[model samples]
Target: MTNHNYASRVQNHNSSIIADLLVQSSDPQNISFAGGYPDASLFPSADLADAFQHAVADNTPAVFQYTDAKGPQELRELVAARHAKHMGYPATADDIIMTQGGQQAIDLLASLFLDAGDGLAIEGPTYLGAISIFENYAPKYYEIPIETDGINLAILEQQLQANRGADRIKLLYLVPDFQNPTGITISVAKRQRLAELAETYDFYIIEDAPYRELRYRGEHLPTLQSFDTHHRVIYVSSFSKILAPSLRIGYICASPTILTAVAGLKSAADIQSPNMTLDALTYYLNHYDIDAHIANMIPYYAKKRQTMIDALHKYMPSEVTFTEPEGGFFLWITAPASLDLNAFMYDVLIPKARIVYIPSQAQYIHGDVANSARLNFSAVAIEKIEPGIRLLAETFTNYLTNHPAE
Candidate 1:
């Protein structure tokens, strides 16, 4: 029998596999390399507490009331200045709109551009969170392949050229800096060409770069927005990786015309991001040195990344290969195409070894790939890194050995 009536969109919207694994991770015995979480030890607790206290004490009744839908002007100005300095682009307060997080920024853009059956392009093995959000609109997904440096521009251009009518993609989503599941960064030449393609094809690019500032090893490349001669790039980023996730602060940088529509959608969605949090973040940025805080965090996360990579090198089998990311919370692993790592996890790895990592099935829109996984390094403790990876490596080797290629 059917339950109460529900919207058709509800059928397509389902919870992320990461969410289910997060619940499993609550157990003390289970070791998880699954969720993409930042280390809590690095958060600036004291400074944030002071900032919140100052915001409430100074703003009083004013802070308690409803603020602008675009968020407090002071915070927007600060974000614009910081973005301009770091991202090698010119921005002003008018060009910025704060959101619940970068996740909301992406959703808002999807709302602005997508309709049912509209074309949407994303990196294959993309961030799972983005997959969940984009699914709500039921857009026709073009799962573009990723290269060692970034998304395959050649293939993407072909798709753009071929689909020039009603099926042409309206929006393109990318995590150019140390992409979430793959840990690959797009090259400078591709960034320029991507911007040019967007102009020629008449589509907008959503540059969702939450991990851009976490680089531990390479020189910083310019943001996609910097290369945008036309206002076709909507840049989204967050403080969740650099600061605390609970803060729920992120911003969208785009042309004022675009932001006006996004702000309306945001206002309808949640009214606005919490006012007190915005004020507190503003106060924190004013008084504290976020750059220095980021500097301190680099070595801490860098150590964890190195530990995970070393463990992989020491233990992984010849058939299995993994990425060596310069900077990011996660790295990817690929096995023989026929291995079916998802089934191996449920039937063998989780029950026998008490180990968990995100399988490649959940990473793609259609969930067709079956022999890869995304392993997060920053969340697990330094002591558990080697053991978790070692156990995983052993399990994989044994499983592959016992069930040779069919």
Candidate 2:
């Protein structure tokens, strides 16, 4: 018999493939390209150690005590200053609210705006993690297809027009810079248009840009939030990609009203992120140069990204196509529509090659795209990239050849 005490909100939610695959990624035998893990070797261990020591020494009992739900004012100021420098706009500490990570920021926004049956629009193939979070809200999902530049604006506007007043979409979420899974960046024109559309349609935009600072090539584009004139954009980012995931440092920059409300939600949800961690981060920012550290990481990650792309070009079947992302931890692969990559991975690739990747089935809200996969490069050892890709290609080729499309 079903448990009656459970909330109905969780009734439709299923276990995410991402969680299971993350466990698979940890196995010593598997060449896992599943988790969006940063290169462990690059972590600023010594600096962080010193920073932690300084935090303890300087703040003492305060670092150990409860702090503001929006995180330390010092850290927020640092985050605001950094945002101003990188995003080409001035931001104050009041505009920033800290969270456990980008994930929490996303969750907070979803909670603040969405109710059951409320209209929510997201990229067709968005970050899988966000998909899982949105599941709890049970919002009416409108998935817009993505293009080389970004989401199809025409279809989005049509959807917006069709759904007006009570039916208008309440929230639109997107990863505008080197988007998760696909690693596609939205064009500046699209970014401007998105801001304009949000204002015109009277909806909010969540620019989930955790990977914004990781660009390895091309000219850096302005953030979607920068173009936002009506305070429609809630900009979210994290130190996970650039610094360390364990820091659990992420922030939201938005208008005063949104920031205040979200801060309340954040406070009620977890009280606040760990004060010690926030203080340490403050010390690190004060003593060290995060931008320079990020700069140092660029070439390393760039090489890793290029290595994976090169291997794909050299070994992947002619029919298989993959993205060449300028930056970001993962790249996307698209196979023939007839091929179900999830089945292929379990039935053949895993047993035969000991390889694992994030299949596309779980990445979308609809879970209908089955021929694609997301392969991560940042976590895997540099030496393993080519061989793993080659093996992955060989396995896929063998399977496709033996089981030709029916």
Candidate 3:
């Protein structure tokens, strides 16, 4: 072994449970409900191909040149316009800083704010990707419980108040719209309360909105940033879900002061985002009706979402409870605390049922997760849903009956 004192962050770079599940599920023999990827068929490949040709054919030098550290200004302006149309927020391009993707936005924000042992707040069962990024920063996480309507505000207020004076919590990270793993959206009332709490407690709110554009049924709700009179909300959105993920384009809207720090961090990290990809995306946005494209894609995902919901209802045991997410690509399922999802998966699901799902233990920062899991319906085709879910339900039912421990 070499004698080198690696930074403590390297210690936590171990293989994650989610990563393991993804690897195992990659086997074609297993019917995987693990990945959160969008349906490949929905990508506008032909249109994007045409746009890329026109973008490169017209201006080679400009397209290949380095972009602004904060990303292409015109693309930021176009994102601002889209925000205006969908979110009713008139944030200027000055408030936006582009990043590699939403994941980079999170990492940049963490780098800008977090120091070792800094206090941060997050939902208990939150986005695994966010947890993966934030963990490396070594923040003291204040995990708040959540409900279907959204985060439990009473508990959140208690935590905020508890950490108020010298504790000085740095950021309250959240995925307010169609949150990952749980598929829960914060209500308007709770959203307002969050804004007020952030102002009162002197903490920033990282409002991640990757899946807001993928909503299928619910009425459009105002974002936390919209209610932030104190400018405490950092609004993040990504083109990964809405457009070509390979473009690796996403943006964050926050106060100029916060964005300045983020831009500096971005420059240090990557100097600038890809100019050619930004040009292609800009050309596509200018020439194409992306809203119309997403509109066309809705029914397909909506049908898939419903099929998963229906399959769960028809096949699952009575003790098995799950969320009926109106939109987005996930369905969160929970069983009794005694049921160990990982053990169940190894012993029953894979060997007998021949199905795989993302166990929720790794989804939490705290290590008490016993009976929760996440399933994705978007990647699997329409025909496979019934058989996979039916088999999974049967396996679970048989296991509960046969085994006495859980």
Candidate 4:
């Protein structure tokens, strides 16, 4: 009926693999765990309303106008301060480049550093958004396997050594803390090695740490950026997880040169982040203690995380194995190798049982198992978790019984 003339670069590019599932899961009747969505009810609406009002009153006409490409200086300083205070990462305000979201930071970094055919190593199963954005550039890839602890560094070393001179590999990208889809954090030892690998391989590490502060259990491991003696790690995080997702505010901390380049790239993409949001975020950060606010939300999510884990253990088939995440919204589940997870999710679960999950097919760059899914626990209500998870477990067990993994 219309023009299908998309650019050649976009031929293989698609909105994450879960896009369809997300759309289906959006139905009011469906118990969906398809999106990396934080609980909407938990947002500090009253606090933010006053914060925005204060920002608008304080800044007047300027608040309505455009902002700097690197975002509000106050907000940037706060981002840097949070890192330095929490993780002991040596990030300064000058090193910060704020973006529309952490996703934009990734895009800006990709544009600034990656060229066509340039090698960009990433965790085999990384953030879906990162894969979609990076695919547009068509950079050669080195997919490292992820372990319970984190990315397998041995494979990373082997890849780096093998591809040492072939291509202009500019960077290695990863979601180190409470990584998406899997909900696993990289180990402290791996953090040091990752920094070392960056130094030895002469490639930068893009540490996408959107959920670093969301930890409800276990010790907070040092970030990869903290281990970097040299300016090799470009650390990016967002307010989406803690404050609000709709704010569309995230900031990157790296070397001044690196951030300068990111700012330039960001400017080319979108002149700057929205002035209103930036001002509001600045006011919120200055006025409120975000850590205390985050702490308040933790008990709720902690209980929900346990709820889902318990439900999975009790109701799911023996053939299924699910992750026991310390914190974070997602839990990775692997079904028997025989079943097509999408078939189970789309045809069986969504239609029959009104349950949904993001299948593992897209998560794996290359892995043995395909019958796996990323189930999000935070979006569902505390009361709804058990019933929803029961439906998921029963449906899975029945699916396996009818069609064994033989």
Candidate 5:
């Protein structure tokens, strides 16, 4: 038998750190703050069931047949209309292409735009999945420092100015609303500044807005797409958070010029996304009030977020600080410099605390930030939140006291 080597991209890629940790500590009772999955209770199962039944009953042969490479026309129109209304952009069905999921959309975008060593500007502590996605393309990532409000404008400007490459940056990717891992939303002023910079610098912006509607507090900030008069922003969103993750339906809204190219690329990549799911999702949107469904989830997740915050306050040490996210599934926690989170997970938390969290270093492109971790409150039950956080706190306290100051 001959052994074959993996592709260079595959060989270079690190296996998903999150998946590795989850598999290693597969305890049903484990209080996991690892994955950014939505609460199962919030899934619109009844609506989806109804939609599926309706699609099956109303099924023409076309329902099961292959769809256009750009996806079902009706669903694309609906998505474009929704994007137009939400982002105050002039979008048409022609400017939208459906993909498997938000991640695939990211991959498709990377495939469409990035060549090896192309400059890609991203937030300092960004989404790990995005890091993985871009790594395969081998882009030189420029990390823009993140502040409480958004990405640091000065640093972004500096990086843009510093990149002397002839290919120029393909695009700057941003999760402007309730960003994953950190839950930081870019402010309106920053959005304007970013748009201006994009226009001046003549680079495209890929605005990944997967968590826009998950807001539990504060007013919604306008998306970067909203301010893009120069046709510089390619906005991507999914039904995963709002409807169902299994549906695997996501759409990209861009200028017709760019979107046309993306559609061709998408067709070559996967031909088309699943038609049955698109039909069902369209039926669900038409029959059900999505706003009400989302409204119901807000309080459910808000309560869970509060539970985790309260637990941390009651049990965590004074030096251990965390962000109070207004929306989204994650909270970024920073422990004292002495605490090695990987060691805490391996030697202490996993064994003693019976909890798991995504080490924050996974979020960084350069792999430097280590004294932090991400906590997901959405997946765990309200009852589990307090105990899990308490256990985590106890583990941290023990680690600090046992390994006191040098």
Candidate 6:
């Protein structure tokens, strides 16, 4: 018998709650509302195929060779320019470090800044993937309750005040624009207040904003990075949602000091993101009008969002509460307190309903949100949403009726 011991970090870490369930339940016929994946139908396959061919044919030897550790210059410039124009940020190529994807960007940021036992603040119900990333470093996780507008400022200030010490906290991780799981956009006032807090506390802010450009309704608010005069914000985003996830190209904008350090860390980690993908994306961006491409996606997602919302209202019990997201792919659902969502999922929703959802327990840093679940309407087709929600509602009703608690 061979025996081996795993590292403490690896042993202590829980497997990705949402991803584990997704893999287990994934079926071609299954109506999945679990993953944060974008709609595959929206991928520009023909255009990307053409761009890939052109990139290899035109660049030849260069396309096959390893490029700069900072990524191809053209792709970086394109990302900088696009963000500057669309996001109202003063981003330049020098301030941007191209990453493999948004996940890598998060990992690199965590690796560069955090040490074990340090404290990092996050919204109560936040992006689970980010929480997973930070867990590897074993940071002391603190949660600030989330409101409809954004992170509850009062709770945030209280947490910060309580945690103030000479050791100094590491970072405040936020997804201000169309946050994952919650799908709540932080208002402009909150963005300003968050910037002020970062400035006052002298801590860095990691704004993971993969879904900022996927707005289906309402005016776009300025990013927290926009108000960051002290260069305290690290704004990370990806072309994954807008273009294609397979390309694995994303970038981070921060102070030259921080970006330089992150670039070095990235170089040691992955050398550089594939130049072929970057070149292809750059070709696509240069040749095509990206704004028009994104504009087309808005209506597609808008209809899907409406479909899910309408179905939920029609089929769900009136006691169930959910948020109407202005942008992004998720609807945060809070079921009646009488229901144990985790038990309901395993006993009823997954088995009887034959549907998959990210139970809200996966979203919390401390694993305490027991009665909530997150529904993603982006990847699933609009036609299937009605029936899927019906299944979900039926499961909820069944659970409530069967497991009545006084």
lDDT of every predicted structure (CA atoms): 0.91, 0.91, 0.85, 0.84, 0.84, 0.85
Can you write out model 6's per-residue Cα lDDT over 1-406, one digit (the tens) per residue? 1224755676545474655677845776567888788899998889899999888888888988988877888887888898898777888888888898899999999999888888788888998888778888988777888998999999878777777774456598999877898899999999988889888977889999999999988888899999888988899998889988889988898888898899889989988888788888888988888888889899999999999999999999876889999889898889877676877777767767678888887778767778888889998878889999998888777777776667
- Candidate 4, clashing residue pairs? none
lDDT of 3 at 265: 92
Of models 4 and 6, which has the larger lDDT?
6
Per residue, candidate 1 scores C-alpha lDDT tens digits across 51-154 of: 99999999999889988889999899999999999997799999999999899999999999999999999999899888888988889999999999899998
Per-residue lDDT of model 2, residues 246-283, tens digit only: 99989999987899999899988999999888999999
Clashing residue pairs in candidate 5 are none
Give the C-alpha lDDT of model 2.
Answer: 0.91
Question: In candidate 2, which residue pairs get closer than 3 Å at backbone N, Cα or C atoms, i.e. clash?
Answer: none
Order of candidate numbers by lDDT, starting with the best:
1, 2, 3, 6, 5, 4
Model 1 spans > 4 angstroms off: 1-4
Q: Give the per-residue lDDT of model 5 (tens digit) for 1-406.
A: 1225755766545455666877754578677888777888789899899999888778777888987888878888888888777778878898888888898899989988899888888997888889889988988788887899999999888777877576466589899887888888899999988988999988888899888988888888888888888888888899899887889988888877887888888888888887788889889878898878989889998898888889888999887998888888888888888677877787788888778988877788877888888888888878888888888888788888888757
TM-score for all models, in order of appearance: 0.98, 0.98, 0.96, 0.96, 0.96, 0.96
Give the 10-residue window scoring lowest on summed lDDT in candidate 2. Answer: 10-19
TM-score of 6: 0.96
Task: Residues 294-324, candidate 3: write the lDDT tens digits.
Answer: 9898899999999988999999998789998
Clashing pairs in 1: none
